[model samples]
Target: MESTEPQRYRFTGHERVFHNVSAIEALPEVMALFGYQRAFVVCSRSIRRKTTWIDRLHARLGDLIVGITDEVGEHSPLSNVLIAAKQARDARADVIVSVGGGSVMDMCKAMQLCISENAYDRESLLKLQFVVSGDGTEMLTTSQAPAAIRQIAIPTTLATSEWTPVSTPIDDETRLKARFVVPDGSPEAILYDPALLQQTPVRLLWATGIRGLDHAINTACSSSPHPFASLLAEKAVALYIRHLPNLGDTTATDSFTQCQLATWYTGMGQMSVPHGFSHWMVHIIGPYGDIAHSDAACVLMLAQAKWLEGWVTPQHDRLLAAIGQSDTPFHAILHDLLAGLGMPTTLDDLGLTRAQVEAMIKPALEHPLVTRNNVRPIKTAADLRAVLDLAWRA
Candidate 1:
């Protein structure tokens, strides 16, 4: 049943999504839209050394491409963010063009904050975090400054970090994420090229699509449902279920395009919806086990879906209808879908031990995200442990 609650859906820095088009083709017009020319490109090191994509981009942007850095690291380490922030600042870059996955885009967004606030060091950067009170109210000071330096993302993976203004740059000192909700910090425009996605290794590619699928499913199962959010997630679920199974087909560019489109619709809606245990648990278990975020989602989504078998029946019905299949239970359907995609489905499959799974229990219980937004109440270590047991072998 839908809750009788009013909700506000906020749009951030997102302006345009140029799909089925390469970055070299779409960037100039996007730059003209903002009347900006100077671009500081950020990408993965592999793309820089291995691919011609960067050289091509440099050729296209010409003098407008002032500087480029590929040192953001996998998790967007805060130290790396500080380093890259200075590079973009010194270059006097008007925009940051992220040409990689979530970490690179996250690095660019944090760089925008560091440059704008002129806060460089860890202590100063840490101050940017919002404080939460005992009553669970958050206190934050906003500059309300219009975004001076926004980002333009060309994602190589299906994790749709480009759609969000919030960036989580991990602090090396604490080994945890520092969240920043910057005004206009999101990509001002996103370029989605299925051809670019094809360059990603197949397992990695399918895993990220599963991550996008995670957003759709968990948002659909959000305790406080927004009708529009649920509606978009419905479509997203269908698309993901349809196209993600075709991961092995390298020639299937249109299917890959469909996967990319599915991510956008899911990301747009899930921005407003509070997610469930599967989503929040990914943060802890993924990093703990050194698994990629999307890979972690592949395993945990199945685990949590199985765990929630009885509790979320109504929402499961909604998802079933969306996929036009009312026969199989949602978890089983998801398990078969993931199996068909050759994705991971258990903690064992991810190479995580029982000890590691046991270790994450305290953190999951302690995490404010789980406490505040997880679909079901997780009040104790036992509560988390119960669900985790199902994950041992899926």
Candidate 2:
């Protein structure tokens, strides 16, 4: 029974999106449009060393390339972000061009904050980090200063970090992650080149594709549903169902493009909806156990589906139809899809132990996103532990 209530939605402004085989060729024109004379490149060390894509970008940008910082780490460590920020400042860069995965994009966003607020020291930076209040409300402490520079993201994976207005940087010393949400944190423009995506490792690419799927699933099943967001989520699920299996064929450029589009749709959908326990669990597992973000999602998504079994809304039926499963349970359908992609479906497969799972429960429950934003209320440690246990051997 669909409710006849009138719905409203808000746009996050029109960002220039370029998608083509030659999308990277438009960087100079994009820079001209923004009056950005000096563009700094931020990416992971692996992307810099292993691929010729950076070399081509440098050649194309010519004198506009101010500096290239490849020091970004997995999870966007604060120390690394500060280093990158210092480099960008020294170069006098007017804009940032991030060409890699989620970590690199997130690092650039945090670097923007560090540069804007002059937050150099760890203590000063930590003070600006977001915190959860006693009553489970998220409190952000961004400086009043406006951002001096913005990023033009060219993502190589389906993590969809480029489209989000939030940045999560991990503290190297404490191994705790902090979220920084600011309106200017999102990228100013995005270039989706399927050819560039071919440089990504197959396993990582497919794993991140599942992460995109998780976004669609969580958005579609949100307790506070938005009509437009539901439409995008359904399309995202359908696109993934069609293209994800073809990712192993290295030459499938169209399939890669479709996956990127699927990521974009899911990213937009999740922006207006609430995510559930799977996202929170992935956040904990990534920092605590030193696991990759996408792999963590692959391990926990089915467990979250199991937990939401009876509580899920009718929108979940759309997800089932997308995957060609009419009467099958949502978790079972997801398990089969992940299995077909050769993704890990259990915590054991990800090499997480019961002790580590137990250690995650307390912190996971305390995180603002987990406690305040989840569809299902996570009130006690036991409730979280039960979900973790199901993920352990599911």
TM per model?
Answer: 0.94, 0.94
Cα RMSD of all models vs. native, in order, equals: 2.1, 2.2
Model 2 per-residue lDDT tens digits across residues 135-213: 3323444567788889988889997887776788899998988788644777888888898888888888989888888
Alpha-carbon local distance difference test for all models: 0.81, 0.82
Tens digit per residue, CA lDDT, model 1, 1-394 = 7556777565654888898897787888889898888999999987888888889889887898999998978678999999998988899998999998888988988888888888789988887864443533232335345566888899988877887776777788866667677767878889998888888777877888888888898878887677888888889999989887776798887888998898888878776766778877877876667777888898888888887788888889989998988998998888898888778888888888888888877777766675555556666788788777777775
Cα error of candidate 2 at position 203, Å? 0.5
Alpha-carbon runs more than 4 Å astray in model 2: 1-10, 131-141
Q: Whose lDDT is greatest here?
A: 2
Q: What is the lDDT of candidate 1?
A: 0.81
